[model samples]
Target chain A: MAQQELEPFFFRSGQEQLFGCYHAPGRGPKSAARKTAVLLVHPMDQENIRSHRAYRRLATQLSGLGYPVLRFDLYACGDSEDECELGSIHRWVEDVAAALKELQRRSGLSSICIIGMRLGATFAATAAVEHGGLRGLVLWEPVLSGALFIEDLRSAHDKMIRTFLSKPRSTTPDEAGLDIMGFPFPDRLLAEFKEMGLGQLEGSPAEDVLLLDQGTDYSALAGGLEATETRLTHKSVAGPRIWEEDPSAGLIPQEALKAIESWVAETMP
Target chain B: MGCGDNALKEQAVTFGAAAPLVGILTSPVASVSTGKAPEIGVLLLNAGLLHRIGPSRLYVKLARFLARDGFHVLRFDFSGIGDSGRRRDTLPFEKSSNQEVSEAMDHMAEQTGLKRFLLIGLCSGALVSFCAAGQDPRVVGVVCINAPGFSHIIPDSVVAQVSKRQASRYYLQVALSNPASWLKILRRRVDYLSIGRALWNATFGRLQRSKSSASTAAPDSVAATHGMQTQLENFKQRGVRSLLLFSEGDWGLDYLHCELGKSVKQLEQFGAQLEVVTSADHIFTLRQNQRELMNRIRTWCLGLS
Candidate 1:
């Protein structure tokens, strides 16, 4: 089979210019009825770098399966211009909206399926709620609560600091507060983020919502979505968090890919 | 004059300014047999936000290895960090301005009388060295390991903006609960009272603007273009070679390589040799990797002739 062609392009969102790479299938349907587009929203920062190869793989696979895929850098990240100017959930949602519009313009596809990891998933969910026309939502290890995510970041920062200090550092008083990589939390972003629980979004019923949790149970997420009248299908895949820089990290979860490909095939048809 | 083998002295020096400049200075075990062992010195810099103390297994190993390989090594804490002074209240990492870094270089030169000086820095420190080297002609060469270009252009305004943003968010939340807080703020500024308020507005304003326009109006014009550009130009003029080491696994490597590639391309336009090493983390932590890095450095330094 001939390989698909991936084209790199840039689009304007407000005053910022966003970068994206679009992959189109070689043997896919040419008619409007068979055309499909998937937008791959990447995790923030280091995870974005670590998962570059995996994301490329997924984009290729999806394109091969007759779905055009678009992977783009969020604002202030990758080749995109700006320096994290849009630190709020709303601003990121706007970026996602811009990306979707751009995808429609470029590929002539009216609908988009969003596949996101971590905070990217949060953005995708917000976009889905606001736009009301996504084909599917694939969330891999999605962060459900901004407060909890902040706590995790703080813990990681504290752990790193402790390891560096050799002597024990005071952690009790500050444990509750969010401090990531020695930077204090931005309250506006934090407050807005706390309101971004995935279970709370009001949107049209998605064609399918696939939640892939690695090394932990996602029953709560599934239950939360169910309560909100959102149909969610959950699965757990065992693997190391390759988003981290550990050399002995595990490979990308096979089940995660299987679930994604299967969903693309079923949804596209 | 190199100390005779019988008259060699080895010691650790903790140079004190308003801030302590803690460093380990190593010299030959013996006096120079010939003129002076061509006094070559290497300074070590750590990665982003990491202090220059504790075990620093990679740093220590590299320094010791370099020292044994016959290069005098001085690894010190950057200001407001590690054993150095408290963090500077400036935007960006300008604890030591370009002038100050040059002064440090001169001081090191005067203290050691070393003919050749090499700076080996990880991440932000590597970017700092690039800026510092432009100002100081005494620095013969620089080895930047996994440098991040993101923080390279941090301006005082940006730093102040970050702090101000934090303060505004804190105060804004308080304003909601306490009318007195709002009253106080209103009284201070019928319009706007604090630097934080101004910064918060500015940040959003920047966000609201198009990225293409923002790129043209970068936060720090001098630091972004002139600082590194001037340094590369000056290094070329002075015949100082530059080396960049990047790793596939390091988070910041790709961006660093891109920035370095741009700088190198600009320098090459002015006639300069730039060597790029493709395998090494920000710290060159792996034993085999460190050795490979050292060998590459040695070859580059030797090839400079």
Candidate 2:
């Protein structure tokens, strides 16, 4: 086994300073040289905590396999020096672009791969659409519909309200309108997210997209893709939903990690 | 609009003690007609990674609410966190000890001349408040909202699993490094064992009893209130009243509530009041709900005074 080393780095996005941990492989053969550097984007809210160790493990594994990996906190997240209110879809996309550029700069790698979980995946997809030179993409249960996700969050919020109120609260999404996760929703963020749909985004098309759906089916998202050269791969793993609150019950499927590693090995130039 | 007319006057101060705590003090913007002067004050705690900024809105709103209801409020950054220049780099929360918190309470008490105090802690702040309540007599009451107790209780079995994982990782790293070093590290493994124990106790000890009851189909409120009762009793021995507030949708509380009822029932048994605010997230960000919750708190604190 080779000694592994990690370097801490910071990049600026607008006025906010974002923090990242870059992991690089030790000396290796040139023929076995890794082509793509990966940027690992974490999920939002409590999901960040739940998936933290797993994300670190992913980064470690990727680096161990001779690829350079960078794991960063979104502005207002982790050790980043910005307020979370500074976290918007546009700002997050900008942050990803900035991170990708920094990853390129630090690794001196030509093409890059993005591996994002949940909301991070949404941002990666949006970024890849606008920016060129992405070698591949890996989305772990990407949020396809921001509006629907927000609606679910709102529904959860409403349920909480009802439970607290000790009265029946409206359950119908139509009646409740578009409010999720305790935050009021207009179409601003959702419209921007909807526009970045994998099928609609413009680029050389994602080289390859590996969607790791925990419980939900990704058929619709897979079927909707119009990318001429892009390959879509979907895998469902039986593990605990990392985003949910129960830590004891949910298991992080080993298959998911294996699939991810396999995909990276196959796709990397 | 003037500072004189404002219900709370804000000032920045620093303590010259070890670790040198610094914070903002907000006194009643206006004097009460009774001239009784509030004897109780509040210390606001921040959410994760937010420092004082996390609690800025809550503290401002709370300060006004409490001040109008007749209590002074102090909102300050923890050392190395927020605006405070010191960070708890090597010291974990338990080991960093409560030295900084005690100084903050002392400074607030001395400045305000308030004989009684209440702590409003969110997330990590809640843990600090718990520790502070244990150490300070001036802290007569506490309201901990959405605190995870510590990072140990995210899953019921997380502590044990994490401990095992950490031990394995440590041993594996040592084994891979050198066989002789592995033996050397094995001799000192007791220290790591103690660290694991401390981590477990710090993280899971707070939630274990309640979690066990929750798993057994016990009412969540009962279990939660029981946990609160024990915490409040610890506070009560020091003359501190306890209030445990949880929002409806907070996923953290979902499991506990399911297993515990409202926990309020248990809190009342310990002479601590528990309140549930509808539609409020962990931080009570919703404008209308925040106002309502603040009003309820004002009424409660007023009754206490």
Candidate 3:
């Protein structure tokens, strides 16, 4: 296997310049995937920070497997534009499309594979429907339903507040229209999440979809995939939940990474 | 105003000689080549294992905040953390960490032509800044928030206090006083075993002087504390400013107090400010807390010029 190169650059999404790192496949035609690439969509807030190392490793691993991968920060996230309360899921979906375009332009790949985690997966699946030509998708522990995910976040937020805080404060995240665990999770974004869910969604653009599950009920999502005549590959892998786990632990879901590498190599080709 | 009309431009850069460091430098677009250095460049180090974005993306917000204030900011992962690859060097991690931090300073100096810097970091990042400020002459100021292991060698007095504070008696008293505490314990939200072990170690760990980390007074303990104090005094002598911010609830506060010993108060005599955010946890997980922390930092930065 030839050595891969990571190119970090900023690409435009409307007026916003989003940060992205493209993992270009190694030298030699034997190692490079000439016409196919992967775009990584990160989870929201702390999940984005937590899963960063995983996604970077995944991108490098995928690039090593002959597919160019681009891991990017969505607008108002990571190293991107520093706007507070960037409150629009619809806008993020558009940013995903823009990332795809950037990935295509950078790698000169016509076919794209989007690998999204948690809420990022929800965004990818949503983006796939609006923008065509996505060859495959790997949804790793995707947010099955936005409403449920919000509830989970709410409960998690409440638990964190209760456990860590001694003197109660006035600002409740659910009440204040803001988030605490990094960037602001605006009320508008929370409202948009009410309409998100893989099962509730009408269609999926990608023909082949890989679901790496971490114990979420995917029956309804599977049914939707079946209805769409999508080539579905479901893998149940148990490991550290990198999306929430502390980064210092140096935890990587090796099983998931390997599963993705094998599944993508087999499914995409 | 958040990231005002300064026309901020950010570029991902790779620096360092053998083991390259990856970082994002956010700057006002118009001021890069003006031949006049900005007042100071802020370097945001990694908070624990959370990469350069800091815990809860604190560094990102801070970088933008400082950039809006006309300060060039570089937020980057050290050698092996975040997006940066590990060094294949023979030097130990501590040595490498120190070297790479200096390398970041060099990179910032080259890009912005700024000789002075204000290093801001949380947790391990805080410790890095603490060490860097002592060593690097370019570091004009430091904002160390919740630095764990500020001093590797724990003093006996701190150990005694930690033992007394974290003792089983303390836990028993608290558990007896609050029904909610017991309820949380019942729900497994509070790990009894871990707490039990921690309390046991804290209480009895010092008794076993040979095995106890607090007891073995390494010859360097005096040197380390003195070195740290000397560094702060050096900053004071040189008119360098510093802000030592901490969360009252964080163990790092105790650690900081322990590390500084008596001279912690003398920092204020040298125009350094020490503050505690009563509502914040170690990471400032609350949005309100984050805002307060940022506001405090901004206020401190504004005072610089």
Candidate 4:
């Protein structure tokens, strides 16, 4: 097995810095798939923490198959510079653009693609739409609507209060925004999430698109994708929602990973 | 407002043999404290499976807060937990964590010219800090937040329902006391099997109240408490100061009382302090609680002789 050279660094994303982990493939017979470099945009908030191990594994796995991969923490998220209060959907979208640019600079390859999960996919889609010319895109259970996503989070918070916080509080959750799960959901970000959705997006972001859904219907997202030369592959895998699962090493859905690996191999070949 | 805005500079670093671990080193633009020793460093540990930034980025907030007060801080993921690669050698976490933590101190010393260090952690991280601080004499102080009893886990065959040794959960007491929980139970929303297990745990007595763990093989509750006492005594004899902070709603605080009823006095006798936050859960899920916890930590660090 070839060694994977893992490098952690902070690079300039606008005025601040964003945390990035690069997985470079060692010298070996490269994978048969296209020479396009891959960039992974991760989910935010608690979903980001829960899916971190899985993302790392996915990056490692892709690198092992001879593709250089970059996974990054957007500004105000993870080890990146700035605070959560400083985070915004607009800024996060720019972070995605910056990350894609960084990935391009690091790989020195013309053909490029992206794999984004949850809201990460939404960000990737939004970025691809704005920037254009992605060779391919993989959206694994992408959050189609930011409003509905926030709704799910609000629902989760209600359940959390019922289980852990039995006593009544001096202030209601709605009174001062919400501190869902553990991280604070700033009111500005909440408003951003409510107003932002893929429904508001127009045009296809990539020439080749793969939508991987599990226990959700997001077919409507690509329904109006209007790229004449584009190809869209839709598939589903058997697995529970990983975002809700307690994070541990190797708790990732392997079947879903395999589906991705297979689709990557078949899509561009 | 949370952290890492202006006063502190964060540098990504790697340490340990072969530089296998990844950490963020936070240093203030200028040291702001004149009351305490200025050369002291603070090391933060991973909470449960959480990475370096910590749950809700609590470690980040605390690190930035302490850095503003003129202290160097480093928060890193344990081997195999975050950006850090897996350890090449196969040592279980309980045994390897202490060495990793000790190595963190060594790395801090070698990197920053700091001699004395302080360790901070939450839950399992808290337990590791307690154990590792005992091993390292250079450690001047230790902060343990919501630490569970280091007792072994009772197997499922022996005691199924008491696997967590936690009371804050909604199944047993939380449900029985709260009218809303009763409503949930009456609505058949709560699982019958869980209620049965809770009843069995309740009827079986100390098994639930004692050290409940996830492992099939851990020390008995009494033995674990004894182990903690030995470490507490070790701190006293070595003149190491300690702070055991707990939230009023966490199972860890309840476990502390259950295992050692008068042990709070023992803790005080040995220069170990206990501060329980009234408005927080185990993770201090609320921002106000995090502020209080951070305040307690800063005060304790400043007061360290």
- CA-lDDT, candidates in order: 0.58, 0.62, 0.76, 0.77
Q: State how far residue A224 of model 4 sits from its true place (Å).
A: 1.9
Candidate 1 reaches a DockQ of 0.01
- Tens-place lDDT per residue, model 1, B100-177, is 455455556777777567777777777776666665666777777665553456555334434444344434433444
Off by over 4 Å in 1: A1-5, A28-34, A163-179, A182-185, A227-231, A245-251, B1-143, B146-240, B243-305
Ranked candidates, highest TM-score first: 4, 3, 2, 1
Candidate of highest TM-score? 4
Ranking by DockQ: 3, 4, 2, 1
| DockQ of model 4, rounded to 2 decimals | 0.32
Residues B218-266 of candidate 2: C-alpha lDDT, one tens digit per residue: 2433444455446667765665776666675444444334433345356
Query: Which candidate order results from sorting by lDDT in descending order?
Result: 4, 3, 2, 1
TM-score, prediction 1: 0.47
Q: Per-candidate TM-score, first chain only? A: 0.82, 0.80, 0.91, 0.90
TM-score, cand. 4: 0.88
Per-residue lDDT of candidate 4, residues A104-150 (tens digit): 89988767788999989989989998999999999899887778888
Full-model lDDT, candidate 2: 0.62
Number of clashes found in candidate 2: 22
Question: Among these predicted structures, which one has the highest lDDT?
Answer: 4
lDDT of 1 by residue, A35-89 (tens): 6688898776545545655676677778777677788867655445433323567
Relative to the true structure, candidate 1 has a C-alpha RMSD (angstroms) of: 24.4
